[model samples]
Target: MLRIILLAVALCLGPIAGAAQQTVDQPSSTIAVEDSAERDAAIAVRIRNILAELEGYEDVTVAVTSGIVTLRGTTVDQALAERLTGLVARVENVVAIENEVRQTTDVVEQLDPAVERFLDRFRQFVTYLPLALVALTAFVLVVSLGFVIARMKRPWDRLAPNPFIADLYRQVVRLAFVIAGLVVALDILNASALLSTILGAAGIVGLAIGFAVRDTVENFIASIMLSIRQPFRPNDTVEIEGDIGKVIRLTSRATILLSFDGNHIRIPNATVFKSRIVNYSRNDERRFVVDLGVAYDTDLVEAQALALETVRNLPFVLKAPAPSVWIEALGDSAVTLRVAAWIAQRETSHPAARGEAYRLCLAAMNAAGIEMPGPTYTIIGAPASAPQQAASPAPAPRQPAKAPQNQDLEAQDVGVQAEDELDEMISQERQEQADHDLLSSAAPEE
Candidate 1:
């Protein structure tokens, strides 16, 4: 056990002794050593004078022997202590340096330097106060001029198509002028280099905010484009993406619509801009069709002529384009005939006119003994041996309907006029929210 203990102790001491030996005998690579003691004393005095002339090194003491210099004492911080080795090496005939300076623990030593720095900064600020004041005044004046110009509403309102677009123009003008003010102030202060930093920071913040509100930005841009190009006017009946309604107003973020059923719908401007739009109110004339089927054995020529005459005699049908009837297809039980007619859509309700025309035409054909049969099926393979039971009384035959006389069907009040209720609602909405609406009736439509 004693032999093992002795071996471990020897192993640990061996590396330590070797390391110390190598450190102590390391040769200086910088300068040749001097033999004279007087030269060493002179070197120490010169280093002390150099330390005294510089700040943060007052407590540092220097000693020299045989061309070697040793630095001892403390500094306020490690950075200053580490800086001493490079400064002392620049001295003449210094072979090597032992930098023993350390960070000081005394609070007064640290506080004194901070107070001296503050006082020095104060003196420089007092000297340059007049120039700083001039720069500040220039900045304020420039910014105030920008504000003054932005507040004038005439130019922006005239340039923009609507209030929403006008507000955007004013905002852009204000931003541009603010940037100009910053540039002028920075130039006056001789700090134009800082402009790049400020702008770069602003760009990063703006990019992040843009991503955060991407939908809102898209909607705003769409509103600007829509306001410029006036797709539809107030009270125009349109179908957008499948939603059929009358246009109520255009807003910054949304397009408001009043549906035919008197329900309000709000769609985002982005969706509206990208969707396919069908403006029914843009054209005064619209075509409606009524499909009727007659018995396959019936003469197609006579059926077409009868349908055309029935649709043409309707009071709401436009006479210039006239009415048309054609054999559409051979249906399962009859021949389908498509009858189409043009109408003044604004004056006539399309659905009501179509329903009334279908009723009158079918009655006229039935009264003329033209059969219109529904689908029929014949059951086969029934056994005659099936049981027979007493039958219930048969239902009475339905009476054939008669076609109305020309005088009776020629009235204008026969459910063909368009409804005005939804139009009234939309007009009221537009009146109450006129300030926010971007659409104008007098503007040319696209």
Candidate 2:
């Protein structure tokens, strides 16, 4: 034990004593009265002492004669060799310095110093192990505390508008704690200045990533906005960029829709946020139009009146905003008329109401002997083999199809309500991704 103690003490004090070892003793004051030989000896001793305290100078030898100093032997490199001159010149009474030191080329000689440096660093690391451990423990504790706070759900959920936003909040909290922990660790290690270097590098990397994924970043931001201010709610019937569908849910990366044909359509949130959206379900009452053409020879006034009466009498058509009928345009062989009426689309489908109105109007027109002719073509010149002078008799009155006896003028709710298959599909999709879905039906529409 005594020997071990002695060895440990030596290990601690060995290099320090070697560095502190007395240099060649200098002469006393009253150097002004000394001769050139005395002053030269003093200068040599002073330069020698300075070199003794430093590394890579053990091979150097210093000499002074007539107030002129000369440094001899080898050092680590030419730069250190040049440094000896400035060091020697600072000594009292030294007139000039000659740097005669050369950098050693011997492999063993060079490797010796490098090995010593490595050993010295290893010793320093060993000495700091306990303190480094303490700093590491502190960092871990701080980061763990942050994770605990971030894992909490109630606060994040209450603060955010939707699940996606709540998850974002948690991630932000975790990241903030990580940075705080880093700062605390660096401060404990007495390396706080290094924190700026770490953050700078992180910023540079983050900027590069942002540029590489500009579109993704845009979609993320759009998702946030969408989650906050819900442009359209779940199950809303909307037409976007000519694709009509019921909204399923909004996710961080895309807006999902259940198309009419039951296929899933995924559009990037960036595009959805930028495109024009036409929401058909915003109002309960919707108007539908159906076009019919009557032969030009038929009375346009009577055709319009009969069609208007037929549509207004239908059970589904709204009476307040009365049904309207008007001449739309003149076709090649007929006069086109447009019939429009309003219905409560929630109860009656727009397509069903429009088709029923068309069928009934055609029946009424045919029953009244009003001809709705097909497209007809005529040649200006006379026919080669047809008779020249012939006055054709008026066409026979057209007969209508078997009407529903008394109520044949109108069709009941046969196909009034459209199938709810798309709505069911949208509900199923929303359930599948409820965790990431940003949409909320209760949220006020934008």
Candidate 3:
């Protein structure tokens, strides 16, 4: 009976030992599987987090099974789908990627967010309607006050001598008031922050515009200064920066000149304002110069007296200023004398007076037996007969003395005609300007 018990105990212990071994092996396999599954799960979570961080992958989904990742979701486009696959493949535990992401082509889905945003804005606007209305009313009232002030011409009557400058001042005042009103309205709406943004944007835009229209601004400023100074008036004979002409009109952009040939010339106001201006018509009395060449043998004092007498007797010459002649230079052929006389430009045409002076002086010189010398050339080698001929004297030409006619009456007629024409042009321009002003006043404000 002891032997039977020992065998039975051995069989029971063998079965127990085998069962323990099997249990140990099963646990080892199970642990490995669990570790692999956990690793895969961690990798999938990491991939999802990475994709979430990236843009245009909001609808993407990541799944992992046995270390292989599968991306399945609707992407915005094929490019994003490819990008998602590439991102997943870079994960540490990921063996491969099954990219099943599709690009959605539904128009309604694309427009849904935009429509919702617009609705939200509309709701906000409706909620602020009362405040908006009050701000608008305040803006309108302030602008109306600016308009009323601009229209009151009596306040700027002192500036009437320069209408252009006056108009500019009025515009500046109106703009200042309007901007002040705008600031007040914005403050009332609790949008003072917006004012800073608006002002910054306006400054940037204004800088750009200033660069683009720099020349125009300069011309306009010069025009205002010229108007206030009144350097020259209409129909004045002027020489500006080498351009000689009669002033026709002075517009905001340019100074209009009627050239001696009757062509219209437009010089920019900035250039005109910066140049040296010579106004021939500013004074009624103007001096004219004539250079006369007489024979070297003639009496210099007697020739001067004769020229002075002739100029004084002319109708156009001014007696108070007087006519004078002086010996100017001694040349190889003759003696040069300068004859100067002052005349009333208003009563005489300068060109006509100058021409008459030349003719009468030549006649007087001839009648007085004064000779004008011809050019004498010396020969290095010449015949004896040639030298004798050069030295021989010739008879002086005689001219009849005739009384000089008064030409001032003709010049006065021409001046009166020019004045009439200028007045008509000015009147027509004024009428057109008035019509434009009326039309502008009648138009409704924007």
Candidate 4:
């Protein structure tokens, strides 16, 4: 054992002694590094101190060559070690970082294609940060437009920006700006020409779509026209195709209404454009005509005066325009009278005022004892035109002297026989006439 120990000692010291001898024999030019031994030792000591400081940190190691640094160890995360190396590089006298730290996980096994693609896309996005900023700006502009549109209109101002129009404008302008932003983003990425190519290909398809949806396109155009012309606005009461409702909202396809029963109605914009619209609120004043017919014998003056008073008393009726009454026409049973009145602010309470006028006028006519005419018919049967007869008829000329006729039975027998013969002849003639009348009644009339 002692022999083996000596042999091992000699083996270890042999290379050291030889190296010392070589250093003494060789010229200084043979050494690659020019720094003095003291300066090298000082640098080594400084690096050792830094390594000692980092020793407490898990999975970290430090090494130094000359003024250069090398980090080596099995690191939990290689990225963290790399970042540490960069941080150390920022410190003074760190000539370079070797970054020899090895990741605990196999790097080749961790690099999946999808992860590589993600990294590539991340790099691209960083490269095109300006495009991303423009997209953000577009979002901000759209939101700002919405705010401006909402606040632009004041409800009471007659000429204030209409909310619907302003909102539409904002939407269109914002959409245009966003599209422009997208175009610019595509251009920055050198892909704007791809969009033009896609559009060129889609042009054919778009023509087919246009033909298929021609009616829809027409309605869209009509909606645009309606928005521009603004024939009617929100909150206006209108009658279209016999449907009357308050306008609530207008959209590209339809106009929404709130019916009297609180049901939501969506009438197609095309229907609106086609139908007749009576805008009751368009004019501040409206003319209302009420027709009343009274019995022919009723006093015309009383009827006219009562109608005029009733119309004048209506709250919505305009006093300046003045109510007017006219005798319209004379009919079979009654005379027609018309009452015309002008109404101001007609939208406020139209039906109520008109109903009140009708009721009050009827009541006034009733108070004045004016008879209102109703339907009547005259029967033209025989009883209505038949003549009357007297009870005795002048004693019929005192008929003649059949005196002493029955000078006994002779006179009575002779008179009875003559009367019987006359009665028989009369009965035969009457039966013939009755048969003729029956035949005539059964025949078809020409």
**Tens digits of per-residue lDDT for model 4, 1-446:** 99999999999999999878654412222333554555545644665466456622355656656655566766545565555654555444445456676666756535553587799999998988987677567656665654555455453223323333444565665656555655655665667787777667779889999999999988877666555556665455678778777666566677766555556677777888888888876777777778888987777987898889877876667887899999999888789999988876433355545555666676667656677766566655458457765555443433222223122211111112432333344345435543211112122221
Q: Write one digit per residue (lDDT tens) for candidate 3, span 270-355.
A: 99889999999889999988888898889989999998888888867899788889989988888998899998887677776777
Task: Give the Cα-based TM-score of candidate 4 against the true structure.
Answer: 0.44
Name every residue pair that clashes in candidate 3: none
Task: Return the TM-score for candidate 2, rounded to 2 decimals.
Answer: 0.80
lDDT of 2: 0.81
- Give TM per candidate: 0.80, 0.80, 0.63, 0.44
Q: For model 1, how does the per-residue alpha-carbon lDDT over 194-236 read when each residue is reduced to its tens digit?
A: 9999999999999999999999999989999898888898888
Ranking by TM-score: 2, 1, 3, 4
User: What lDDT does each candidate get?
Assistant: 0.83, 0.81, 0.74, 0.62
Predicted candidate 1, C-alpha RMSD:
6.3
Residues 1-446, model 2: lDDT tens digits = 99999999999998777645522122222225445787788878888889899988999998887766777899876788877766665567766566789999988988997899899999999999998999899889988998999899899988877788888888988899889988888888899999999999999999999999999899899888878878887877888888888888888898888887878888888888889988888888889998988887889899999999888888888997888988999988789999999998777877778888888887887787788777765548678897777777856654423434344664868343344766766677677767878887666667
Question: Taking the candidates one at a time, how many backbone clashes does each contain?
Answer: 0, 0, 0, 1
Return whichever of 2 and 3 wins on lDDT: 2
| TM-score of model number 3 | 0.63
Off by over 4 Å in 2: 1-49, 63-70, 92-98, 379-418
